[model samples]
Target: MRRTREEAEQTKESIFQAGIELLATKGIHETSMSDIARAAGVSRGAIYWHFENKEALLREIRGRLQSFYKSLVDAAHIDSAPLAESISRAVRKLFKKYRNDAAFRRLQDLNIKISVLYAGKDSFADDIIKTEEADIQLFCEAVEGSPATNSCSPLQMFMIMESLVGGLLIRQYIRQELLSDEDIDAAVAFMVKGFSGIEEKTKTIHQEQ
Candidate 1:
């Protein structure tokens, strides 16, 4: 029997979800099409109909993750708020999502594996670099507009923010460290203070000019 379009789409989504879960748990090298099919409760034929191979499935997963990040950035009400407020809100939203979304957390773990394995010839690597560049630009703009960041150039503030977020995530994920509420609050406070210092320096530079 021929499946309806909606049914086809649902099946495709199921396959992708199953692939992601398996990739996260088993690592890409260990996961097979049959494994995915079994987890998804679909035929191996169905998996092939949806994806050419494991690499294709990984590409689709990367594309979906990129789309998700773009949607989050697009929906942020940054333009309506003070620069500091907008940035703070965005950062908070990001960490909150990291804490809550199992899929996101899993994807991140998968990404780390991909980065290590395909270090040289990976399309996902290029995509990650592009994504980071875009994020840095947005952060720079926000920092420049905020009263709390009057001392530093947007680029400097961007790097600082990136370091803080990256460090936190690494510690939380790789070290199996528990991230308590107090930890997040302290981290944010430290970031804000650092930004404020940069702003002061920027003001001094402007005054000297």
Candidate 2:
């Protein structure tokens, strides 16, 4: 029997949904293509037809997450905003996802955990790394156009900010802490303050020179 294109698309989506649930609950190492097939109620052959491997399925998940994160950054981007403001917006955007986007955040938490476990040896690890770096590059752009640009490198600033976000996310995952509105606000404040301190210190040094 020939399957319609729409049917195929639906099956693919089902497989992805199943894969994400399994990945979140079981972690990548425990979740397999067969597991996804069982959960999706599709045959193993169907899973293979849709995705070449577990990595391929995860790549799709990562792509969706990348698009979601990109939308947030695009919405928050402002030409005239201060770098700290831009960074705050981006961080706040992340916590918004934490509160609202469960699947993406699960993938995000798993990606961080797996990176440490795999240590750059896994091919799929690069997808997560690249996606995160590309997202943080938004803030790097903001730094480039900021008045404090001379104080620090935009790439360095981006790295610092991204690390702070990443660390907090990892902590949340490990501690199983729920990030409330107030918690998110405080986290954003800390991020803004950390970067602002750097900016101000650099400014004072420049003035002294």
Candidate 3:
């Protein structure tokens, strides 16, 4: 009997989730279609039916992860809120999401490995760079729309915010530090202060210019 469309989608999701788990634990180089099938509790043929190969599955996983992060960022809608409030909220949500998502945390580890291996030679690096640029642009636009718009150029503030967030993530991942809710709040407050200070400096510079 042929499976229903919903069943097919369910199976696909199962396979994808299983693949993510295996990829996180075993690394992409160590994982095979057979391993994915076994982890997914599906047939090897079923894995093929859903994805052409391991690389295809990896690409799909990357796309799904990217889409998930993009949606989270979009949901913050920082452009409509006051500058300080928006930045605070956005950082809080980001840390909350990172803390809650085991899969995402694992993915970040895997991505770091991939980055080190590919570094300057991989097309994937270009893709990641473009994605980061797009994220920064969205953040800058939101900052520009805030009440603090006159305080700083959107681009300058975004660069500062991005650097702080990136640094925090690296430290968290590398040191395996315990990140509590209070820590997140404090970090966000610090970031907000840094953003405000930079903006004020930029405004002063512009006035002088």
How good is model 3 by TM-score?
Answer: 0.75
Q: Which prediction has more favorable lDDT, 2 or 3?
A: 2
Which residue pairs overlap in candidate 2's backbone? Answer: none
Q: Write the per-residue lDDT of candidate 2 for residues 1-209, one digit (tens) a residue.
A: 99899999999999988888888888788888999899999999999999999877766765765654465356446657656776588678777888687776787776665567667665666666777777767756644655456666877666666677778888888888868999899988887787678778877887899
lDDT of 1: 0.70
Indicate the worst ten consecutive residues by lDDT in candidate 2. 67-76
TM-score of each predicted structure versus truth = 0.76, 0.80, 0.75
Candidate 3, residues 62-159, lDDT tens digits: the string is 56546434542464374565466666776677667667887777766666556565577667667666666776666555455543556656776665
Off by over 4 Å in 3: 67-80, 130-137, 145-156, 202-209
Model 1 alpha-carbon drift over 4 Å, by segment: 67-80, 122-124, 130-156
User: 1-209, model 1: which lDDT tens digit per residue?
Assistant: 99999999999999988998888878799999999999999998999999988977876755655543443244333567545445555566667677887788777667666767777865757766765677556545544555455555667665666677767877778876656777777777776566556657667778899
Clashes of each: 5, 0, 0
lDDT ranking from best candidate downward: 2, 3, 1
lDDT for residue 176 in candidate 1, whole number 0-100: 65
Task: Order the candidates by TM-score, highest first.
Answer: 2, 1, 3
What is the RMSD, in Å, between candidate 2 and the native fold over all Cα? 3.0
